[model samples]
Target chain A: MHIPSWLLTFCEYLEQTASLVVLLPLGLAFWRWPRLPKTMRLMTVYLVFTELVLLASSLVELYRPAWSYGIWHFFTLVQTLLFFRIYYLTLSSPAVRLLIQFAAVGFTVFAFLDSLYLEGLQQVNSYTHVAQSALLIGLALLYFEQLLNELHITRLEQDPLFLVSTAVVLYFSGTVLLYVFVNKLSAPADYASHQVIYTLNSMVNLVQYLLFALAFWYAGRTLPSQSRP
Target chain B: MNSWLLPVMLATPVLLLLALGIVGFVLRYQRRLLRQQEQLRQVRDASQQQALEAALLAQEDERRRIAADLHDGVGTTLAIAKLHLSTLGQPNLTEEATALLDQAIGEVRRISRNLLPAALQKFGLPFALDALARTVPADGPTHVIIEQRGQPRRLDPKRELIVFRVVQELLGNGLRHAHAETIEVSVDFGPDYLSLQYRDNGVGFDPAAGDLPPAPGTRSGLGLTNLRSRVAVLHGTLRHDSAPGAGSKVWISFPIPYLPADQKPALTTSV
Candidate 1:
């Protein structure tokens, strides 16, 4: 569990600067391309919301760690709901849309109950995190399948939804097992191991957000002419 | 779990997911390329079809103009000359001179008809085709037969001209190239289509080879190309079946267009 000092510093820097690196481009894109697809615009809003929650949670953690955990747990549930809405918009099938809606609602309820009764606000919400990651991974895979099935997209690289879905698949699949075991790495004795795990998680977050920036930029450049419902 | 196995286990799925993302992007890129290729093909085909239609329309216009000139200009002068010759009732006129003047008038009329047949515009397709069949020498090597299977229907004038030209080209090809003993031209008016079949027992050539050198004393095979272009303008199908030593058969089918009630009366009256 011995953590390297450089790794801890790198992780801290990533956590502190992620908002600027990720959210700035997305916000600028939203500003520039007011006519972007509804799903893309909502994604930018969700990302800004996530950054706000991260900033607020960090401040709360400095004062009271337990309260910060609660905020994060609530944020996780909100993020899942937002993602479900985004996927619901992109996907064409009614059956899949209904399934995602049901899963979103079910997961929100489960995360709430798990935070209150099972994992509690003091501990890491590892169970809900793992479940969210698993579900997002499934949705990402489904989005790719839908992409292939429809084959209507003329330029995949320029499609904001396609780019965001690719980022989701990569980041969620990479972090699913890590999140599942995050609680184990939370002990005071495992501080070093926790930092390492979190650092890896931060790296994944950085890559995911970079992809989001790319998607937003693509939308800003192309969405005015290519807007769809 | 072994400490070493931890990163390895984590890295495996991450790598796999990254690989999957790459594959998804590659697949999408390929799909985009295929879509672009198909679109390009469709555009090329559309332009080609447009060009063919324009050329065919211009050709039809030119033929009509020439037909009018031959009829009103040269034909009128020939009629006047004949009238003037007939009025000369003097004994000085030799029988040879009288017969020669009559022959010259007949030649002018025949040339005028060949340029644009008056029967085609005045009567309709069947009469025009019959007149076409009559042009073939009765005692010549080829015997031409015209047959109608179903009830004849008059089509739009433009479409009728297209069909007429197609048949004309096919018949001309058969007589000039096939060197066949018999040529049968059949017209069938189905409820949904107007079908024409031209069959001739001549020195047929392979249609797949396309535009092979004609036999001695025969012209090049440009008529079939023109025939195909004319058929395409009507959105029709033209099939040529032939082999060397066997006769050639050209089948042309054009869809029957739905005419408005007002147009139907004119077509029926014309028929």
Candidate 2:
């Protein structure tokens, strides 16, 4: 795919502008105060992973014809997979953890195989995106339900856990909407038609990054008070 | 420019801003409330201490007035009566009459001593406490035991008096209301704290469900508020634990910031 120059410029803007302007402060917070809240820690980890994806996509944008879309697609796939992994680890159920690990490994293998040969099959790619979106929503829902149901969690509304979880819901809902609907209904056949989608996607990334910062702030503040053994 | 995408795109900013506004308001409100609560607590503690001091001073003045009246007026009258009685040898005075007159003198002396223990001024708090403890009857259903632990350091006279009165009130309450089978009173001295614990195996009241109003006449009723005030002056905390069908326990701990280094073991000075 000979990607359009305008689309390339937009991706580069997101890659550089969002990384420095959005993710940098969050990174600083993570560095300066390593003892972030649980929510913040999880959000930072998620953002760092997403930032890596964006950085990879940026590189792909600059390289143009030499690098295939498959590379960027694979980046998204791996990031989403890692996100789900983070979700499962946080819940900390031994049985669920084992189950997610097994499922993820199998899914990664399948995604890699699909990336190698399924470029001609756009529908397969779409279906894969749908699956990732579903997983994100499900993980978000599970995290929310756990936070709400915990009886020992006094001052739940003020809790960093609740804040970070709310952020996660926002990011998940926004991302799912973009992935599952925007491309199908709005993007034209040409790469130029996808510019708006790219811009919207960057805006979503910006929102996600900010929420991640909040999560970090909350986690750092609360961790010492609870003082888990 | 699809109608659907337009509405979603425009609403996002407003929703995000609204959420931020709500968060800021809640945080500010909580902080303000916390500050107000702390201020209120300090004010309440200050007023309570002032009232306790005024009450103690008034009580001391009343005690002194009673002691003076007994010594100057009553004591002189009794002495005159004794002198006149000794002169009754001039008449037909029987042995029974002489014995009765001698008993009256003994009773007068006992009353005068009970009214004011001269040892309280000379011996200080530990001696006074021991004297009071010795007077506690051992024949009741509740066997009261007193244990003084660690080195006893001398406290200010006013503090000692307050402690004495508080302990007396506690003993009275236990005997009258608690119907306790056994009562153990302990004074524990620590490096920076002096603690008193009164434990009784008695029919306790539910702190949550029981009457929240202060019990009148009992130490817990009238004297506890005063006791708390005295403890507060010394930066202390008092806790009471009781439950229906269970026993009652009172724990009071206050700072002892000025204990002398060479204090002796005050615990062994018991009846």
Candidate 3:
């Protein structure tokens, strides 16, 4: 793949901008408000970790070749782990904590095998991507059930749970559509399809970040103010 | 993984997910705050109603105490005075002197009975109501009847007192204001409900009129409003049905639980 100099600069700029825009606020939230809900804390940590991975990926491509593959594998493993956690919290009943433990062990074993066997790296990556996407879609469906009779406007007026649930649905749907159509339409001869897929993916990313911020704000200010120790 | 492609893809989704999570948290927090506010409002309303009822009950207790003191202490002293005066007078004493002592005794007795009816404390509601029925003038065109349909049960003293007082106040108002000749008091005891109905044959007034009577002694310039307040606290419904020259009927229905301890009277026996 022949990369233009301008496109490289743009990618680097995007990397720095995303780190500042998303990670900084999340970092501050975790530091100042240590008493945030477990769900929210998990999400914030996930955000900061992802941002650092992306930064490392960009830094590896720009300045460090020998270490790039190792960093990618490490971040990919982290991404899979975080996705599982999000799915577990959003989908499973609180009483079913045991299932999450089983999932963690399963994913850890899979990640170790994928890292050790470099010959099957692409296959492992593709498998993890599909599994992660399936889990998110499943989670989104579970939350949609939580909001079965719930009207979006009614929730916007009264309930923050409804708002969070709706956001999750939108973000999950966006990712599903983007990924399913990404390779099929974006062949080398057809640059237009590739650009469209990337644009749609970026838009989905933008909406999801905004929604996450809203969820955090609601959690911090509107939730029951039992003086968190 | 293309070094550039992997990070770009990962970065975009992560940022978007964070945004969605943030929004969810804010909305949830707002809902919680609103719920707490509504709960606080309900608590305040309930406390206010309770406070008003408490103050009214205290006032009634004070009035009952004062009425008792006058009847017992003052009536005793006056009787003793009458006895002494009679002893001091011999056969030689003038007719006017004896008549004066007798008149003084009658006045004292009337004052004591009016202050607190003896029937109320001794015989319960039915007997007291019969006494009230007798007080109405016989010459009036309207006839008054007091009837009990089912076996009567002894209510808790607190509940019985309120029912009796309300009935008294309602009847008194009818006599003074309704100009009705015939008044009927009927008590019906069903499986779950106890109903008291007072119907008069006078020119009825509009219910929407601002001058409608309040609680029981309120119309009598003493305790009607307080009586109504007490009934409301007992979770009973008091309703008024009236129109011009149509007569007035007041119905009070209460769900007083039937306990084994409640004494059931044999039947409707006249006072």
Best by lDDT: 1
Tens digits of per-residue lDDT, candidate 3, B220-261, equal: 222335545756766788877787778888888888765344
lDDT of 1: 0.75
Rank order (by lDDT, best first): 1, 2, 3
Q: Kindly list the per-residue Cα lDDT of model 2 for residues A1-229, writing each as its tens digit.
A: 2446876686768745655656554665667465764434555666666667667767876886346356556665776776666677677567766767776776676666666675432322554565666666566556555543333343445565555555545554554545555545464454443554556656666666665555545554443222122
Locate the minimum summed-lDDT window of 10 residues in model 2 chain B: B262-271
The local lDDT score (0 to 100) that residue B195 gets in candidate 1 is: 91
In the order shown, the candidates' DockQ scores are 0.07, 0.04, 0.04
Candidate that beats the other on DockQ, 1 or 3, i.e. the better one: 1
Error of 3 at A55 (Å): 44
Looking only at chain A, give the TM-score of model 3 against the true structure. 0.64
lDDT of each: 0.75, 0.61, 0.60
Highest TM-score against the true fold, candidate: 1
Quote the positional error of residue B15 for candidate 2 in Å.
13
Q: Write the residue-wise lDDT of candidate 2 on B1-271 in tens digits.
A: 3434555455555654554554455445545554565588789877887776676667766765676577677766766766776777743564556566567656655555555545554565667667767777778677888788887667655566556666666776777777789888888767777789988887776666444653542222334566666666566788888875577788998776643656532432211
Deviation in angstroms for A127 in model 2?
A: 36
